[model samples]
Target: MAGAPEASPGESRLRRVPPAEVEAARMEAVRRYDILDTPPDGAFDRVAAMAARLFDVPVASVTIVDADRIWFKAIHGLEGVAQIGRDPGLCGSAILRDDALVIPDTRTDPTARTNPLVTGPLGVRFYAAAPIITADGHRLGTVNILDTKPRLITEADTENLADLAAVVLDAMELRLSGLRLLREEQERRKAEEEARTRAERDTEAITAFATTLQRTLLPPALPPVPGLELACHYQTDSPRDVGGDFYDVFSLGGQRWAFFLGDVCGKGAEAAAVTSLTRYTLRAAAQHHDDPTEVLDALNSALLLDPSMGSRYCTCVFGTLRPAPGGGFSVTVAMGGHPPAFHIQHGDDGAMVVNGVRPRGGMLVGALENAQFASRTFHLAPGHGLLLYTDGLTEARLPDGTMLGEEGVAAFLTTRTTPDAGRLIEDTIALITDLPTGPGDDVALLALSVPLAPATEQTAALSTARTLATPVAGAARADQER
Candidate 1:
């Protein structure tokens, strides 16, 4: 709202002032970057140096236009000069345009011929600069090259200087993203600490704290995927104790996605910490390498090597889904000492068949430094779905005093009429709810399926109920084959 700082004794002041609102917005942009008078950064210094060398100029600088002065974040070929005033036709003028500003000879340009940089002791002649613009159209600064003697440059040279500006903007964005993540983590930790303090005094507070803490470990809802349906549910055995079961569904780029479900070895705060680490490591690793096996291997290393993750291990199944040419999704799953996921399909006779999709020889993650994970690829055709769950479901104690086991789960799937993902989750939840004694541990379920197309002759027949064990012929056969 106030006027720009007055010019020094010899420097000419800015002749025109931007609208108050525009100046206010511009200053806000500068504050968000937090780049004013900051410590030197090697990456920025390199950009300034490269610009000077590439343009064969003696002076180059990465400047951030501040309220009172033009701050040099990085400078080359300029000694003992950290910044200069907002001169009329230098960086302050360059930042006003959308493209690069080039004056082949500053002495011949009417607007800048009298500027101090041209008339002062430096006796600058050539000046070229590209405005460093933000994605939202805020011109934050400039990347400029200057010469003591007049010179000319090709259009390509101007473009290259612009590219250097872009590089600077990208580095800033990446740094900003990291800072945001660090701040969020700190806030979450602070909230957790306050919750724990209150939990010690009130019984009700303990339950609410555990519930809120657990929600943070898992996604609130599954993301919608085109041509596919998704549903997930998590049930913890106790409200006062934190469970380590976690699952996530996220995009891996266009038309492809990655999902994972895992459980850490123990319960309470230690297990909760490991659960958080494992879930984030999987998401980060998927960005670099989409291979299910490689992603799991990265999690394994992260767990085993992290000093904070002592004695924690996990069983996980990581998988990816992509659109299939035949109107379904192609799936590839990798396992690490985890229970098998069930593939539910309808036969030509319309009989429902359930098979275990297990890749043998996958080891427990974080249990060993040299762990080997296994992967299997399969087609999730239309009228089919896959169900992944934690061991809590199979280990549930029945009224008859026997565990449900994998065989019991396969048998239960046959009783369902459809492979719809949401229905599968609902039925599974109901199954656990009806038990006289509830599940003994936490249960996390993730189901994905493609919508069945218009009724064809193949699917129009009367449906039957059946079971086929492919990857796992039977529980015993599975172990024998492995």
Candidate 2:
């Protein structure tokens, strides 16, 4: 306590200390802010610097009054000191008042004359402070400005100091709020990342299970049919969900093979289950009956008996192929609300064309107990073949909003010469692949053709001409049929 003035015989105190309860509550409020003893902050330091410049004071500080000390949170102009005893500083008396305290000449005032800072070697003669009050009516500390020479402060000076103290309180509240918001935002981001990771893992597991089930529903490889060359392809719309399209070729006994292609109503696990039931049922039913129509009738009955089907149905094309008497094949086809098959014929001139053959008036099977199905018979001679496909082909949309309907398919077929089943299928797949948009449904294609003669026997004919000539009689027959 330097520069303290000697006490006179009769002198009154400048300010009264708060009651014990009030002082205890005031101290609790200061501790609740959690700001004391912390490191220097730029925000509070800036306020102290601005206060010094505005008042033209040699020293300015933001100080908090504790039980036994006045501690500086921010200081300007003073060096080598951070705190002092409660009894020696002007800020201690300022904390007991609700308004600013101004001592123009501390040495002349009886209450401040005995203060050590004024009478000691430090020589602080003028001091002004505004109380930093809490929201609950407790004064915690002050924003103080001090000078060595005595000087008077105007009313405007007192108001400016009050405003500066308000700025200090605002900075403290904002800092606390900002820290709380930052912690909440970090927690939200962590939760979202964990949810995303879990979803990805679930999708991978479902896709693997669907792929394994799909493989079991189809034939491993087409059983080689004597006197016929076969090629089939299937395409799925998405790898994440199983599609409803299915096709199989299996043997019934000697010289007879059963083949079927179908599409169920929806997608995913339910449609996959239906597809499996249809495929196995057809294989077993064909053995009990020789007629294609009777086999489809049995399928209709089985679907109607099952309650789990739940108003769902499917469209199918079922057929049996057998060797003809002479040198070709005869196919009996039954239809159940399915697309027609294309019979591709080669002209004598080697130009290839397509002819669609459909069974008349077939009903949607599995939807009704007494649904009707129809059958048709066709002969595949040498240099002839047949192609069966799902509606996903003809229903595909081009960029120009035009559909590749039945006529479009016929035009596609007429572009090729010599009906080779594998080549025809490859060209059809390329057409769909080249479109700007993908087909929204599943596509399945099955082509069966009669093989050409051995290369040795046709070597002389091949040498004579690379292109086959169109005969007058065969051309006339094709025109009459058209």
Candidate 3:
């Protein structure tokens, strides 16, 4: 016994140190529950109370073992106490074994004699515990029972303690599964919110691009003309897509004005590109040519020359306006595979007359090598108006599923009592919007009228308008004969 080391007061001789890797894994299992130092629950408290009653012991605890301490999750009959140092004779030693640890007399047992629970104030003399083992073969801690006096217990009593340990493990597993489900739900909601934000941003970007491109394809505002009234309207089926319908009114010098309205073949960017070229080409051609027919011929030639036009063609009506020596406008119109322009005038009985001016034999622009066009010269007498439109209006479906064709337009125009350009555009827009199915394609409208003079001057203007109708009226009557 010489040079022997004395045992410390809180130490034990029964401790068996596990391999470093084994201990590390056990520690990790303890951390996985995250049960250390948490608030007490009534569930674990009830289990501990049952253990104490079944074994007739004064104290019972459900514990979790840490590296340096053993924490009590629930303790029955042990007040004002929560944890203690990791002594190998108690809960720490029980967790190392697969079965229950039983010491009937702690004071007489060499392994437990120096443990703090035996030497301290409470003087615990009997102790029994079973390790709470996970399915993966790692032990987290124990369910322990202690008494102040030494006593013997049967094998059946040891089995009861182990059953209580299994109860504690079940509670931990249920709590862990609930936490995992909550974490998964939070991640799902976060992903959906991110995808929704990205879709909104893409929609806004497309709208902005369509608006800017549409502006470049049409005139900002119609130019003002002396002794004449002009009005226009445009409508598109979708805000997100660029339409191919276009119109413009510009001066061609020397008291003459040029105007055109057309519809390209498709929708979206390609259609918009062709619309821009068509508008500018017509405007540039009008400046060089006095006749409306020559202006349209020039546009047809330009569309054929540009390779970028790419198999696209259009239907258009081009016209020139000059002051008549009588009292109205002398008008010349050229057509290229387009709808008839409506001529609204007053009859001999002062009733309204709506006539469609269809010059014969015009071919589609940009469709062939030598596409022919047709032209007509007419007298736009006072109290008369001309309406040019794309086919989107006539092609619109009615409530009866029938198309509102050229005849329907003529019938609508017949209801008007006076020639007013601005009122004509406003009423036309309202009609289109109130359609049963609305316009299926893009719609463009352009109207021109020479204002009527006062009652006394109107009489003189009428006689003058009739005299100017003589030579040009021959051309107008020829169109009617067709």
Which candidate comes out best when scored by TM-score?
A: 1
Ten consecutive residues with minimal summed lDDT in candidate 1? 473-482
Task: For candidate 3, write residues 1-482 as lDDT tens digits.
Answer: 00111233444533367799998999999999888999986447756876887688999999998888889999998898887777544787777677888889988887677777888888989888889999998999899899999999998788768867876786676456435544644664665578987666656655555565566567766665666667776667676677888888788888888889889998875576567557766876676678877877866765664444567888899998888876778898899999999999888988889888879987888787688889998998777889999988999888999999989888888887776776676667667768888877777778877677622221211100011012112100000000
lDDT of each: 0.76, 0.71, 0.74
Q: Kindly indicate the candidate among 1 and 3 with the higher TM-score.
A: 1
| Stretches of model 1 off by over 4 angstroms after superposition | 1-201, 454-482
Tens digits of per-residue lDDT for model 1, 1-482: 00122322433323245687887898898899877877887557767876886677898989998877788998898788787777544788777777787778877777667777888888888888899989887889899898999998888788778877986886576456446545755665667678975434454555665676677678765665666767777778787677889888889998889999989999976687667668867886787687899999988876764344557899999999888886787899999999999999887787789999999889999999899999999998877889999998999878898998999889999888998876887788778777778688888888877767632222211111101110111110000000
Which candidate should be chosen as best, given lDDT against the real structure?
A: 1
Q: In candidate 2, list every pair of residues with a backbone clash.
A: 2-120, 3-119, 3-120, 4-116, 4-120, 349-470
Q: List ranges where model 3 is wrong by over 4 Å.
A: 1-193, 306-310, 454-482
Score candidate 1 by TM-score against the native: 0.55
Instruction: Return the TM-score for each candidate structure.
Output: 0.55, 0.53, 0.53
Give lDDT tens digits, candidate 2, residues 253-349: 8788898988888886567656765775687679778999998986676555445567668889999988777656788999998888889998767
Query: Any residue pairs clashing in model 1, and if so which?
Result: none
Candidate 3 backbone collisions, by pair: none
